[model samples]
Target: MATEAKKSGGIVETIKTVVYALLIAGIFRSLFFQPFWIPSGSMKDTLLIGDFLFVNKMTYGYSYASCPSIRIASLGINIDAKDICGIFDGDNKRLFGSEPERGDVVVFRHPVTGYDFIKRLIGLPGDRVQLKDGVVFINDEPVQLEDAGVFEEAAGPQGPQGLRPRCENGPVGDGGLCVKSRKIETLPGGVSHSILNISEQATDNTGIYTVPEGHFFFLGDNRDNSTDSRVPQAARGVGFVPYENLIGRADRIMFSSAGRSMFAFWTWRSDRYFKAIE
Candidate 1:
């Protein structure tokens, strides 16, 4: 009888330990860092579809967007950030917030859909932004762009979504090489990064967009492929993201996998582990 009682007590202690550990991890994830997985190729060579990184939440301080949204379809658990931190929503302010710099790679909540979108910050508050001939123009001046050869990848399906790449030289066959023109873009304030050009598209040229006060403009590095601030939110685009919607900045990639599952050890991209985001 005593042995049975001891076994039961030990099981209860183990359960308590696990519960406590999970609670601590949840708090840490909500307050400090939020793990983000690149699910699309909008950022392209800068951030691949399988790249996994931690967004530094502390960099932009706390907001309602800081709360984690947990959704497990199979388990039937759905929780939104607004559900958890709805009390903190509205007023368009963050608790200890600092303005994000232009050219910073940021992940923020979509102003309309509440989905998370990652893009390069382009225009800050009260700045004029536009795109002409595939080059970004900020404050009515074109950003410097230097040719950087071609970015090549397989024409086959990529990542778990099985999405195919859009090539500058396409109708590429299944296993053929897909290519895009690469350029090194130098933003104002001396921040430089790689940008890919697929082909001429409507977003390549735009009317002057004056960023509103307390809002920002963003763009994807994959010039023609991304649906960013250039389009209006009503048309399913992320237009003029609010300051309070900013979640965090993704500074570096922590891990990367080319396969459908991250657990597939052989499919891991060894070169991208712990790579600092440029």
Candidate 2:
């Protein structure tokens, strides 16, 4: 009888140990490094639909659904199950001191549907941003373009696709798609990054927009195909993203896959893994 009691006690202890280990891992994954999957081509060339990315949660701070930001005490504190559940249940708000900078690629909760999107910052507070003739202008200066030649074609299980074509003829006069060269342009704050041009004609162009305080203007790398701040807020597009909506800056591309096919697993491009985002 004594031996049986000892054996039962040992089994219970082992179970507790396993449970605690899993809890710690889950907390780390959620608060430090969370995995995100790309689901659209809005950020194409820079990001793809089948790409798997690791979003550094600590880059900003603890985001609690839709409520304002809060302090995270430690990694293993099991204090608020309500807060964890609130991620999908409540509103989104940012913690204090969580500000985004110009040229940071950020993932944020879309103001319209509360869905998440990753986009590049173009205009900051009190800056005048406009899109004229398919070129982005900040503070009345045209964004400089540097031709990078053709991007390497990406291959998938189904077949292969060419790089995002460049647009050189300015915006099309008739509102059709045009591909031109890609280039890196410096913003007013000396923040430089690459952008794609599709023809010289501007379609969803906007006039001088003084980005209001506590808001930001974002545009997709795939400028012509993206529905971003250029569209009015009433049209279900982002007019300006509040600081609270920001999740974190996209630090790097963890991995990438090609094609728009459903079976993306077999099409993974092993060479693209861990490529740093430029």
Best by TM-score: 1
How far is 170's C-alpha from truth in model 1 (Å)?
1.1
Q: Candidate 1: worst 10 consecutive residues by lDDT?
A: 259-268
Best by lDDT: 1
For candidate 2, the TM-score is: 0.70
In order of appearance, the predictions have TM-scores of 0.97, 0.70
Full-model lDDT, candidate 1: 0.93
Looking at model 2, residue 253 earns an lDDT score of 70
Candidate 2's residue-wise lDDT over 1-278, tens digit each?
99999999999999999999978867776566656667765665677666778766666665553232233456654443235545543344455436677777778767766667788898888888988777788888888766765433323222233334334554333234544456676766677666665544455466877888878999988777687888768987888987666666777777666655435656677777886665
Span of 10 residues, lowest total lDDT, candidate 2: 153-162
Q: Alpha carbon lDDT of residue 135, candidate 2?
A: 73
After superposition, the stretches of candidate 1 with alpha carbons farther than 4 Å from their true spots are none
lDDT of candidate 1 over 50-111, digit per residue (tens): 99999999998989999998987889988989999989999889998988999999999999
